[model samples]
Target: MNTQDPLSIGIVGLGNIGRYHAEQLTSLMGSFDIELSGGMDIAPTARDRFESSFGVPTYEDHEKLYETVDSVIITTPNRYHEEYAVSALESDINVLIEKPIAHTIESADRVATAAAASDGVCMIGFHNRFASPVQVLKQYQQQARFGDVHHIEAKYIRRRGVPGRGTWFTEEAASGGGALIDIGAHAIDLALYILDFPQVTEVSGVTRSIFGGRPDYTHLEMWGRSGEGPFNVDDSASAFIRCADGSTISLDVAWAANRPPNNEFVVQGNDAGARLDLSDGDLTIFESSSAGAPHFSDSEVRTRDDDPHRIEQQRFIQASRASEAPTVNTVEQALTVQRVMDATYRSNERGRAVKIDSEPLPTVD
Candidate 1:
């Protein structure tokens, strides 16, 4: 096979995000060389509509689709990511899983093990890492713009926003948890990526179902409309983490909070600080001063320029070709995030600090 030739890709789970990937691939037509091998989805309605609209063969079973494509993209719910990804990788097919990897740390471990055992590449979808502004921040870190990183604060706050609430999202068995596991996963991943993934030594957290636990809370809407159904999961969560390097990360996430000003990720260091606001694709940098003049100074600014999805796709394909390890959120990183989530919930339930299970995460490399 020619190294320059495009690879065949089979996408599993043709949901809304999956459709976006398909459209993006088609939009790149001539410039972006690739073949859409087709897809598989358990949903009959989704499969029929996707095949009819895209003119791509649809497989009801993923095993049949895996036999046809060189690589598979898993975009199913968080709970199913590990099962699907492991199945694909075990069959010697590369896999690109959507965010969060899996609902549990143990499942994440299985996915990583399968990837390591097979002769295929595996990568997790952390699209924010591909943004231009984020890339600049990474470059700044490489250049030591932020000397001796120490603290991070991330917020994924939304104003009355919970997707498919009372549906799969609110169900702990299906879409994982509520807003924290869904959106907060991205924020946590981004913060860890920026900080070079410091080893978390301890985590203390709390979860709240302030809005969805009451009878009157039934009026709250989910996904898009009002009163979709009953929501039982936490609408918000907050945590504090101490890293092995003595650095710290403060995280807060919400599906529907009465707070003003949407979402942001602020990374502070001894020498400088970089803040990325989710509402807009902007990153503001501030320089720290040892000598007193209000304690901080301003520095160079960077902004996102390209579509994060496109860059992420290109990177995954390239990594697949090389059979190289994932530099970003591999299974190990994902499991770490899951550990934090699990501990947070446990702490919330027990009304105290939950001890983390100290175990080394498996590596894709």
Candidate 2:
């Protein structure tokens, strides 16, 4: 495939996420050199919907779609992530895999190892890092304007946004650990990214199945039909993470809670601090100036609401074109996130803070 030609992109798992990628890629067609080669899914309804909605070919299996694309995006359930991602990397096809890396640490390692060895580029989908607010905040941190950033408070809670019962999201075996692995992945990645991926030392966490597991749980205008099937996964979680650099993170995420929705992230630094909404991209910076009288200052900065998904897709195309691994949002970073999650679960089980191993993460050469 010539780099000059548009990159042929295929999507596995034509569900809501796959369709979302299709929408973002279409918007990028006029700007970036990309072509939606096709999509693959086993479900007839999903395939039919994707084919009709995007006017693209849909496949029942990956092999057929693999032949026509230069790159692939895997948006399948957590457990199936390794299957598609590893296969695509083995084929020397560039890959953009959605987060949590895989369902478990073992599975995530397999994906990371494959990404390290493969000739093709592999970038993890930690799209929130591309949001305007995060991008701007990262610039300030990079410039040393925020001094030594030491802590972050990340929140991504929903008032009553739990998925319907019996869906793959509600299944422990399929979705991994529920809210922790779902939204928690985003919060962890953003916090670490803001801190420049320092070595994690330990994690203390508590997970609760509070609302979703009950047969008597009230729907009250929540997602999908409530009280239908088994709900064994957690609905909310809280965790604290410590890093080798002495930086820290407090994570709070949920699919369903009694309080109103919250999507805020606060980064605390020695000289300055920053705050942003994870979903809305609103940003505010905090600092104290002693130019005249000693006083504190808070300034709000607004930026173009460029869709993070679209920016992520654009970067993936650039990586695929160069056949080089992305410098940021690498599979290695995603694996680190998986490690934190694994430790958090262990911490919950042991009722104590879990120490993370100091082993080096796999890196692409």
Error of 2 at 200 (Å): 0.3
Give per-residue lDDT, candidate 1, residue 347: 74
- Give stretches of model 2 more than 4 Å off: 219-229
What does candidate 2 score on TM? Answer: 0.96
Tens-digit lDDT string for candidate 1 (337-365)? 77777777877788887767667666566
TM-score of each: 0.91, 0.96
Candidate 1 Cα deviation (angstroms), residue 365 = 3.4
Best by lDDT: 2
> How far out, in Å, is residue 308 in model 1?
0.8
**lDDT by residue for model 2 (184-208), tens:** 9999999999999999999999999
Q: Which stretches of candidate 1 lie over 4 Å from their true place?
A: 1-5, 213-230, 288-296, 300-304
